[model samples]
Target: MPHTPGSYTTSDLSRKSGDIIAEALRHPVTITQRNKPRLVLLNIEDYDRLMRQSDARSAMTLETMPDELFGEFETAVGAYADSDEAGR
Candidate 1:
């Protein structure tokens, strides 16, 4: 496979952990094994940001959602239902 930026093999990770972690602090790094991608190393800020984004996408009660987001959700659901009915 073609070499990807920020990608390191498992052996490279074991041998060059400090260097790899430094690089990960600047951006995400992929850890590969057997030429397949296995894991990602990222800074805590990036990880937390990803988790927050995931939380935003997860199921929530209408009462818990902000008014703007609820409006957008309502609009999206209506558009999706309209499209689905058109397809049928």
Candidate 2:
């Protein structure tokens, strides 16, 4: 198999933990087991940033959504209701 940068096997993790962790502090690293990607190692800052980005994307209130998006959502709901009534 081709070697991948920032990827290490389980055995390499055991033997070179310090080096791997140092690299992870600079950028994310992938840990592999049986040649399959298993885990990611990253610095706390990167992890926190990723979590914040995920929360921002997933947790949105109608009050926070822009007017255009709210209008589109309203139209979609209205269409769904019309379809349901037609089916009934």
Candidate 3:
């Protein structure tokens, strides 16, 4: 389901636990107390998806990339140095 997580105060959570949890199962829900966000509620599948994405990002390494990609990366870097935004 497509959903954008919405904030829920502690009081709100306590008053609407079922609805809040059901919403959280569809998308992450922000839990707040005293106007400060304290926690996130997400379903297991979504949590696992986040973990997998994080793991993939953490495991990235340019050194392990193919030679063609490395060469293209180098070319892009050189182009950056040649561009007007290098100093900025």
Q: TM-score each candidate.
A: 0.60, 0.61, 0.54
Candidate 1 — which pairs collide?
Answer: none
TM-score of 1: 0.60
lDDT of 3 at 81: 84
Q: What TM-score quantifies how close candidate 3 is to the native fold?
A: 0.54
Candidate 2 residue runs with Cα over 4 Å from true position: 56-88
List the candidate numbers ranked by TM-score, top first: 2, 1, 3
Q: Which candidate's TM-score is highest?
A: 2
Model 3, 28-84: lDDT tens digits are 899888778898999999998888878443344797988997899899998988885
Residue ranges of candidate 1 with Cα displaced over 4 Å? 55-88
Q: Compared with the true structure, what per-residue lDDT tens digits does model 1 show for residues 22-81?
A: 999999999999999999999999999998878555677999998999999899999999
Ranking by lDDT: 1, 2, 3
What TM-score does structure 2 among the candidates reach? 0.61
Q: Positional deviation of 76 in candidate 3, in angstroms?
A: 22
lDDT of 2 by residue, 12-80 (tens): 999989999999999999999999999999999999999887844556799999899899999999999
